[model samples]
Each structure stands twice: as C-alpha cells, then as structure tokens.
Target: MKEKIIIIGAGVSGLVAAINLEKAGFNSVILDQSDRVGGRVKTDYREGYQFDHGFQVLLTQYPAAKKYLNYNLLDLVEFDPGSCIFYHQKKYYIGDPSRKLSLLFPTLLAKIGNVADKLKILKLSKALKKKSFDDIFLAPETTTLVYLKEKGFSDEVIKKFFKPFFTGIFLESELTTSSRKFEFVYKMFAEGSAAIPKKGIQAIPNQLAAQLKNTELEFNTSVEHIKANELVLTNGKTLAFDYCIIAAEAWPIIANLKNQESAWKSVENLYFKVKEKVIKKPLIGLIADEAALVNNIHYQPIKKSDNYLLSVSVIKQHNLSKDELINRVEEDLAIYCDIKVDSFVKYFKIKKALPVMHTVNYMMPPSETQLKDRIFLAGDQLSNGSLNAAMLNGESAARAVIAKIKNGFINVN
Candidate 1:
C-alpha cells in the first residue's frame, strides 16, 4: 500500500510538497486553514482593477522556479532591466548597459553613483556570475552594509542606490540582511529580469497547485496539532498519516512546537488607480529620501490601456489609521506627481511580510525536515525568505519523506 502523507498549511511550500509526494506515488492530503490556496500571494479585484496583497515581483530566472513553473504559461510582463531612482528632488535612471549599450555612458553619467561605484557594480556582477550558487551562500558572511564598505563601494552609492533599493526589497531600513542573501539576490538580478504574471503573483502558486493528481486538498480545515502517526484537526477529528509535513511560517510552526520565535518585518502597501499613466514606462521608482513615507512606487502597465495602476510600498509601520497613512503618502507623492488622494483603491498592511535575516543567524542550519520525533518542517525561513527557497525546501522535505518510507519507517521518539 502507498504511504499516507499529511501536509499542513496550503502555502507554496505545502503545495509543492504535496505535488512532489504525489508524483513519487505517495497518497497526500493538503490541509489549509484559509479559504484561499495562495497564502501570502493573493490578488483581489474590485472596480475593474487588480491589487496584490503586497508589492511583489518574480525573478524570471530563479533557478528553482524553472524546474517546475512553465514561464510561457505564466504570460509574464517583464519590466525593463533598470530602475528610475527619485533622488534630491529629481529622477535619475540607472540601467544595465549590457542589454542596451546606448545607456552605458548615460547610466555612468547619472548622479546615482560615482564612476568608481559603477565600476564596482560591474566587478561584483562578474565575480558573482563566476561563483557557483552554493559557493556564494557558503562564502564569508556579514551584514550587507559592511560587505559593501569592504568592497570599496562609496557612501553615495550605498545610500542613493543600494540603501533604498534593498530597503524596499528586504523590507528593512538598516541593511542588516545577510550579505550572502544579498549576493544571491544580486546574482539573480544580474542574470534575469524581474517581472510579474499578467494575472498576479498568485498565478505562480496556483500553477503549482494545479498539477496535483493523487493529492487531496481540504480547504478551511485547520490542523490543531501534528503527531508522529496522526494529525489533530481543529474540528475535533484526527486523521492518520505515515508522514506529516508542517509547511507554515516559522512563527506559526514555533508556536505549535513551543519553540523560540524569530523576528519578521512588516509592510504597508497602498494601491491607487489613476486616470492616465504617471510614469511613462513600467519601472520601479525607489524613493531616495530615507524619511519619506513611501519607499518605492511601481507603475503597473496594462496592455493597450492609458489608465495606470500604482502600487506603493511603505517601509515604516506607524500606529496611524489607514486614512492618516494614506494622507501622508499622498502628500509625499504629490511632490513627484499630481495624484488624487481620493483615488486610492485599496490598502494592505502585512504584519509578517518578510522574515528578517541577520548576519548572526544567516548561515545557521536550515530548519530540520525530519524532527527527532518524526515530524517535518518546511518554509522559506528555513533557507532565506524567497519564493525559490520555499519551493526548493518543500521538494527537499518531500524527498526526505520518500526516502524514509522506502527505508521502512525509522525509529520514532
């Protein structure tokens, strides 16, 4: 008889784990508390406009993504391999000259970075390309800020470009994220373009979830407790399984397991609909001012439409109400463009948007897939908090389960 597997939480990791186990000829059941399959990645439509839970982008060349996701089916919309930085009351364009040779001199001439800093970027790019992905992760680790300083990057460049860009990406202001993670992220950018599915980021997970053949999905069914031989559901029912995978975030898993918790960063996203396009091109505008209410603004382009969908990410989390925060963001954005505050379509405040990665814990061992007592864990926090890490770790845990089953169920504590 095929081994029975129960996977808790229907996020990307849980879904991926189920898919892999089913493909390997195991009977799998996926249980989720929420009604939606896409946990963090979700989209809502209202009044003829679409808004994601938060500002998100998919790197077209994420190594793990290519292994499963079909890029053509995603119908991706690629952004230019550049960014428009709003600095000192002016907008500056910094682009990859390699793709468009014409922008080589202009990007260097732009005030975003000095000649030396620009040269360092190219040097770092080439160096990263040469190093294997594993080597980059295992290299000497430190805070990203210190790593930049050690690499001879100028303060101007770190502040103007690196700080704002990374702050928006990592959802942190101190730039204390692991340098190794920074290296990996930079390598991905150097290799591919950042884009989103024409539908939404949810499309990525939805595509993965659609491939299950022998897996049973129980939506709105929460698992209260996990055990070595069975799972206790919130509705006072227990289901038996040979192997169980806990694929939720670290905090949720820690709470259930009664373990210490890790810190996470929050984000406040506000979406606006404009009558006409504000930024001419579909590019991200990094707010250079550190004290500003808005960290970055992305102008989402709709095919053959003059109307614009603006997604703004706010780094600071204040106790102010939604209207108050929206007012502040509108005031700051007015300096750059003429926008109506009343044009706001939706707002999303995500408390645990990103898992913080400090240098001290950056290289620590990933969460144990096979617990001493026979349980398993999977999530982005086990690696770094990225879509690629979540999917990869899920598959790794599934393989571990398969191997254990093949070996005839090891000793259980």
Candidate 2:
C-alpha cells in the first residue's frame, strides 16, 4: 500500500514537502489554516489590481529555492545594485560609501570624521564576505555593534546603513540576533541580487502547489491535533495518514500539538500604492531615523502602468492603527524620496511579516522532532528561517517519510 502523508500549512514549506514526498512515491495531502497557499509570498488581486501584503524578495541563490524556481515561468526580475539611498537623522545619502566613486558624494552622506573612516568602511565591506558567521560568533571579544565599532565603523555609518538595512530585513532595530542570521542575510545581498517574481512572490508556491494535483488540499481548514498516524481538523474532520508534516508557523499550530509545542517569531509589514512614482529606482531607499524606525521602499516601477507599490516593514512595533502607520511611512517616504504625501492612492497593512529565526526567542528546533517517527515539523522557522532554509527543511522532512515508505516503513533522505 502507498504510504499516505498529511502535510499541514499550505505555505512554502508544506508545499515543498508535498512535491518531494509525491516524487518519492508517497501520497500526500496539504492543509492550510488560511484559504490559500503561500503564507508570506501572497499576492492579493480582485478589482483590476494585484498587491502583496507581505511583499517578498526572492534570493536566486538560495539553494532549495533554486531547485524549484522556474525563471521562464515565474517571471523573475532582478534588483541588481538597485540604487540604494539611506535616511539618517532626517538627512539622506544617494549611494553606499563603501565604493570608491561613492566617496565623491561624501560631504552629503558620509558623516565620518575623515578619509580614514571611509577607507575603513571600504576595507570592512570587502572583508566581510570572506568571514563566516562562526568567525564572528565564536569570537570572545564582540557583539555585532561592538564588532563594528572595533572595526572603526562610526556611529554615523552604523545608524545610517547597517541599522536601517538590518531593520528592513529582520524587522528589528536592535542587532540582537545570532551573527549567523546577520551574515546569512548580508551575504545574500552582498553576493547576489534581491529579486521578486514578475508575476508575484506567490508564483513559487503556486507552482509547487500545481505540481501536486494528485495531492488533496484542504484550504481554510485548521488542524486541531495529530495523533499516532492521523490529524484532526478544527472542522471536526479526522484524516488518517502514514505520516504527517506540520509546516505552519509555530505560533498558531505548534502550541496545540498532540505531541509538543514550538516557539515562534513575528514580523509586521505595510504596503501602499501611490499615484506617482517617488523614487526612480524601482527597488530603493532605506530609513533609520531618530524616530526609532526602519523600513525599505519598494517602488514598483515595472508595474508603472499600475500603481506604485511602497512596501514597508516594522519588526517589533505593534499597536499602531493602520492610518497612523501609513501616515508615518508616508512622511518617511516623502523625506527619503523627496516626494509628497498626496501621491499615495491606497494603502494596506499586513502584520507578522516574516518568521524571526534565531537560536532563541521562538526559534524552532529542526525538521525532525522528538516524535520523528510519526509527526514532522517543517517551516522557515524550523528550516532555520529563509526561503532556502524552509524549502530545504521541507525536502528533508519529505525525504524522511519517503524513506520510511521505501524501507518497509523505516526512515531515510
């Protein structure tokens, strides 16, 4: 008999698990608490417009993601060396000072004391690529900020570039994370392009889901529990399976698990559509100002025929109303892009932006858990948090189930 697998959460992780398990000759079904797949990689469309609340950027080099992405079909667009500008203490700079030619704009943006400071920045940026996450973390002498200060990065550069960039990426102002995560993210931007599927970030998951037409999908259905070899849904339905994969974010599904609960991390994101384009570079701008906030401005110029999309991220802050948040971001955008608030046409806010995967603070353990024999956990959080990490983890979990089925109900891949 074919081994049956029940995968929870139709997000990227779950979808990946289904595809791989089916390929290994196991039957699988996907279930998501939401009505659709692609958790953060979502695209909203209806009234002659398409928008993504959790506007995502895909890193082409992310290994597991690379395995499934079809550039021809998904319409991948590159944001290479996309004109980067920074807003620090209300003042802005046009480019990164680490480059030699960039120094010509020094007086405008580089608040460093002298040429030596700029040289230090150039040297550090070059050397950062060679260093691994372990080299920084295992060092007895430094925290992230301390390491930068020791490396001669001034308070000005830290506040201007690193802070804002990190905030937008991690959604937290403080660099209170494992150096590995920082290095992982920094390396992606440093080594490659930040891209989005021309169709939308949802294309990746949509493609994966399409591959599993033989696999049953229960959308808008929440799982109530998982037992020896079955899952119970909130709708009072029970599904029997040879194995189960819980790929949903740990917060909602993990706590009520039949076996165990996993920790979770949350991120907040906001999106706005404007009447006029604010920044020429479609993907540009960063904000790390005295207001104690940071976000990225994604001006959708390619979709110029439509509205300009400005997606902002605020990691730790909560409790602000939609209008107030949009107004503040509008003010920041105006200052960063030298545009006015009247340009905006519509706005939408989506909170809990991305999974914050660190060694602690809601970090999930691994793909295979203590109950590895029957139930498995998969997601970016467990995959150690990245499109690649999440997909890799899902593949790992699927391989495990496939191995069990192949080895007369034992474990492998």
**lDDT for position 173 in model 2:** 71
Poorest stretch of ten by lDDT in candidate 2: 360-369
lDDT of 2 by residue, 157-180 (tens): 777677766666665677665555
Per-residue error (Å), model 2, residue 108: 10
Best by TM-score: 1
Q: Spell out the clash pairs found in candidate 2.
A: 171-315, 267-352, 267-353, 404-410
After superposing candidate 2 on the true structure, give the runs of residues whose Cα lies further than 4 Å from its correct spot. 46-48, 88-143, 250-268, 292-294, 303-307, 316-319, 343-349, 360-370, 408-413
Return the top candidate by lDDT.
1
- Per-residue accuracy of model 1 over 193-291 as CA lDDT, tens digit each: 898998888898889888987788899998776555777788989899777887885344334556657778999999876666555666788888766
Q: How accurate is candidate 1 locally (lDDT)?
A: 0.78
lDDT, each prediction: 0.78, 0.64
The alpha-carbon deviation from the true structure for residue 295 of candidate 2, after best TM-score superposition, in angstroms, is: 2.2
